[model samples]
Target chain A: MKEIVVISGKGGTGKTSLVASFAALAEKKVLADCDVDAADLHLVLNPKINYREDFSGGKKAKIITEECIECGECEEVCRFDSMYYPDPENEIPCVNPIFCEGCGVCVRVCPVEAISFDDAVNGEWYVSSTSHGPMVHARLGMAEGNSGKLVTIVRNKAREIAEKENLDYIIVDGSPGIGCPVIASIAGADLVIVVTEPTLSGQHDLLRAAELTAHFRIPTVICINKWDLNPDIAEQIETAAKERGIKDVGRIRYDTAITKAQIMKTSVVEYTGGAVSEDIKQVWRNTIYALG
Target chain B: MKIAIASGKGGTGKTTIATNLTATLASMGKTVQLLDCDVEEPNCHIFLNPHIESSTAVTTPLPDVDEEKCTGCGICAEVCEYGAIAVVKEKVLIFPELCHGCGACEMFCPEDAITEIGREVGIVEEGRADGFRFIHGRLKIGELMSPSVIHAVKIAGRESEVVIIDSPPGTSCPVIEAVKDTDFVVLVTEPTPFGLNDLQLAVGMVRALGMPFAVAINRSDVGDNDVKEYCQREKIDVILEIPDDRKIAEAYSRGEMIISAMPAYQKLLETCWGRIIDIHRNWGELTS
Candidate 1:
């Protein structure tokens, strides 16, 4: 199966919007939202979850106060500043969960062995059925990290579903920025589509994203959204992409109907028939042709 | 006062609001500082068009094994939580990318076999833009860690009377690093399903951090009123509403701040600042 991941180096560049439209256009595919920290593809697709699983991405250190000594050794070794003596008069230290990076230095350095490292339930994942096909998505807990591991789990599950169902494609909505989560989503994908706009930040972020894809040796395509906002910058972005050996797949004009369709809980392609819809259709056609 | 502009979803106008606010505050003769902490895609500099006065490389510590003094006891690898170090057959392998620069392995090494060496991850640029201090961090392409660079950028804004931090999208470590220790957080969002979903996640994040925050709805006329109603129900103060205008988008595409491109926005930003001060004052009273 061919796996295509859509990403934007900057947020709010319409990666999920484009992925939702692609799900409507693709014939046989499994949808995955690797933007696990703030998963929004399900809001448009409205998936009916078929399976659910709890995810423990990493461990957090907790203090066992009963065995604690007032030596302050754990506090001295803690690099994250999570270990603190809340009650100095009592001389008992505590670990602030928010500041703890879960590095376990305090647990190892405690003279009395009072610190314990426990697996943390970072988030949840789901295998669901949407109108387009099967979908794999996840949600990371508030103030939680380890999104890279969750993205990997979601992608693996999507691949499994695609293989079991004989799917032809897996369209993934990747997270923003060139971070660990983006790396996990881009690695091993058959094609990468970078959805960008015609703003200065858009151009700069797209270059950073393209560098990431180039490092992975992944073939990439660029699609400019809201291309009419600044035709000059749009042309500039295209020229920059061409210099990097990346081709432009299509461009979509700014449309208020795109947001309206989102409010109606459907992809723009499925919710409206307009010039923007036509542009998305052409994008899908070009994507399919490029895949071949 | 320090205010951080953040959105859980990307491209929702954090930089737009931040740049305009800083420009407006500077025009009012306030000592303003704008820090672009979104190191992965630092865009405040683009709109501000600052003449960078100085640039410095931000480095993180990476462990360099001392083979001469090493016993290969594997203690350094054992103490590392990120799996950045591994002992294989008397040889220590270090993965610099995975290292968090916590120095735990170096501290716990039984044979004093580990020492930290600097690894450059990004650059922090400081300069002046329209009489306000402009500082931003640009993470090296393909670099995974952004919090360290963001932390460095935040330090540069500490001396200003008013600091505005433009944070990266997503409710993760990078966002936390940008918003932490700020007086107030202005969560900028559009009014769509994706926007609302991500906004709710951002709200949860801010609440978890126990910080006072307000919401600003950009492109207010485009989508449904679900965002407004949610804010009302949640008692989240709607500090500002920036109407969708083609001229604004065009000016943004040209890398111009709204306060200058559309002079009418100056009054609007001033009113937004008023609301922020009022909210912050009331928050102080409630806490006190």
Candidate 2:
């Protein structure tokens, strides 16, 4: 099975939109939205969740105030400044959950053993059936850390489903920025399609993203969205990609129907039979050929 | 006052508003500092075209095990929360990428065999854009630690009278690191469904941090008005609205700041700054 991951180093580069359109075009494919921190593919695909699982990405230390001795050792050792004194005159401290990085040093150093480490529910993952195929996605809790772990879980679940159903491809919608979650999404993929625009920021981020894929030794293909917005920058991007030995797979013109289709809760290919739709179709064809 | 410009979704014009606002503030003779905390892709430098004054490498501490003094009693491994260390058959293994530099393992090591060594993850560049201060970070490709780099950038801009942080697109840890201690957060979003979806997530993040925030709708005329209605219902002040114009896009594609390229957006951004100050002042009154 060939796995194709769609990524854009910068956010809001239409990664999910392109993935939704690819889901409509590809056959016998399982979809995974690995952008768990802010998953948006479901906004268009409208997946009906059939399986749900609670994810405990990491542990958070909780201090039992009742068992506390008034010594301030825990606060002294904490690098995160998570220990909070409820009363200014008192020594008893409470752990602020947001600031705590779950390092567990407080639990180890507490004289009275007042701190207890417990599992925190960081997020949830779901396996659902969509109009395209089996879709696996997740939602990271607000302000929660360890999103890279959640992305890994979603991708593994999608790979399992693909194997069970004998699917031909697994198309993943990756998160923005080449951070931990992006690394987790791109590693071990058969091919990575980077969707970028024609702005200077777009060009800069695309280069950084290409560097990441090259470090992982993953073959990458480039697609320029809204190429008509700045054809000069688009040409520069193409030349840069070629210099890096990356191929340009497609270029979609600036189209208003892309957003309109998203508002109507459908892919661009399904909502319109216009020039943008034709561009997406050609991109899909190029992707399949490249994968082969 | 430190203001953070963020959007839960990418490419929604966070940089556009941030760079333009910084330029406007500098033009008004304010000591403005713009820190692009999107280390993964720091784009403010491209728009500002700042002259680099200095560059410093940001490093994180990774544990190095001393084989000579060590008994592999597994005490260090037990104390590590991230499982960054392990004792396998009288040998210690360290995973530098997984280490969070919490100093737990090094401090609690029974044999006193663990020491911290610096691992460079990114670099922070400080410079001047006209009269305003400009700073940004570029994370070494494939580095997982961005919050550390962002923290360093924030520390560099702490002394400025007005600091504007341009945050990465996401409501996760990196976004949190960028906007946590700011006076006010300005969320930039378009009016589409996807934009609204991510904007709501960003709003939840800011509210969870107990930070006062407002919204700025870019490409205001392209998508529907659902975003505006949602903000109204939530009682969030719509601070700025920049309509969809081909001229703006052309200027942006050419790497020009909207304030200088069009010269009309200066008044709009100044008005937005006025709303931010008003909201921040009221929020301070309620809290203090």
Candidate 3:
């Protein structure tokens, strides 16, 4: 089985819109949304969840007030500052769930053993069915850490489903930036499709993403979304791709229909069979060939 | 008052709001310090064009195991949750890239063989831009953890009365670190489907931190009304709405702040800042 991840270093560059079109065009494929922190692929795909599973990437610290000696050692030792003075009225060191990194440093340093590691329900992953195929996705709780680990879980689930059904491919929509989650999504993937816009920031972020891919020695194909927005910058992007030895798969034109499809909760190909769809179809074909 | 601008997703206009807000405050002759905490991709520098004075490298401690005094007991491996240390056949390898610098391995070492060493992960640069003191964190390539550098940037700019922080995208460790002790947080987002989804995440993040915050929706005319509806349902204050305008996009492309290119936006940002202060005051009253 082959895995192809669609990632854009910067956000709002049309990664999901392009992935939705690919899902509509691809055959016998499983889909995964690896942007667990703020997943938006479901906005377009609208997957109906089939199975839900609890995800605990790490532990969270909770202080037992009754057992407290009010030692304040945990507060002094915490580098992340997750422990704080509990509302001066109470006047005890407390653990802030949002700030905690689950490092267990505070828990270990707590002289009274008041602080302990507790399993935190950081997020949840779901295996769902969309019109296109089966999709795997996850939603990380607000302020939850370890999104990279959650992305790995969702990707592994997608791969497991693909293997069970013998799907030909797995299309993954990755989060923005060359951060932990994006790295986790593209790691061990067969190929990476970097979707970028034609702008200065676009070019800069695309280069950063390409650098990350090259570090992992992953084969990459570049797709310039809204190529006409800044044709000059688009040329620079193409040149940079050549300089980096990354293949420029194809260009996607500016289209209002893509947004229209998103509003209707459908893929662009399903929304309109116009010139933009044709361009995306060509890009999809080229991407498959490049991966091969 | 230290205020931070953050969002759970990228491309949600955190820098746009932060830069413009700083410009607005400076126009009012208010002393403002703007710190860009999005070390991995600090774009506020592009908009602000701060004249960088000096930059200092930010370093974190990683365990340096002494092979000469090693027992190869693998105790370090068992103690490290980040999987940065491993013991293999009388040899110990340390992957400094994965270490979070909690000093757990050294604490658990029975032989007293582990020593903590520092490695530079990024740089914190300070400068003046648009009449506001600016500081930004720039992470080195291939550095996985960015909160350490962000912490350094925050420490470098703690004296300003009104410090505006531009936090990185996502509702993870880095964003939390940026918004931890802020007096108020402004969650910048657009009005699209992606915007609302991420706005919800950002709101939850801020609420979890127990920080007083409101939403500033940029590109409000581009997408659907779901963001507005969600804010209304959740009783989240929509402090400002920036319409989708070609002028703003053109100005952004030229690296000009919104209020700078469109002088009319100056008063709008001032009004938003005032409302933010008001909300924070009211929040303090309620909580205290």
Best model number under lDDT: 2
Clashes by residue pair, model 3: none
All models: lDDT? 0.90, 0.92, 0.86
Query: Where's the lowest-lDDT run of ten residues in candidate 2 chain B?
Result: B279-288
Instruction: State the weakest 10-residue window (summed lDDT) of model 3 chain B.
Output: B246-255
What pairs collide in candidate 2? A11-B10, A12-B10
The sequence of per-residue lDDT tens digits that candidate 3 reaches over residues A1-292 is 8999999887778888888998999999999999888898898988999999999988888998888888778877776777778578775777878777778877877788887798889889999999999999999987888888999999999999999999999999998878778888998899999999876677878888899899888889899998877778888899989988998989999888877788888998999999999999999999889977
Best model per DockQ: 2
Residue A237 in candidate 3, Cα distance off native in Å: 1.9
Candidate 3: docking tier: medium
Question: How do the residues B25-101 of candidate 1 rate in per-residue lDDT, one tens digit apiece?
Answer: 99999999999998988888888789999999999999998899988889888878788889999899998888888
Give the Å error, residue B85, model 3: 1.9
Scoring only the A-chain of each prediction against the true A-chain gives TM-scores of: 0.98, 0.98, 0.98
* Candidate numbers, best TM-score first, in rank order: 2, 1, 3
Segments of candidate 1 deviating more than 4 angstroms: B284-288
Clashes by residue pair, model 1: A11-B10, A11-B11, A12-B10, A12-B11
Instruction: Give me the TM-scores of chain B across the candidates.
Output: 0.98, 0.97, 0.96
Predicted complex 3: DockQ: 0.61
Better of 2 and 3 by TM-score: 2
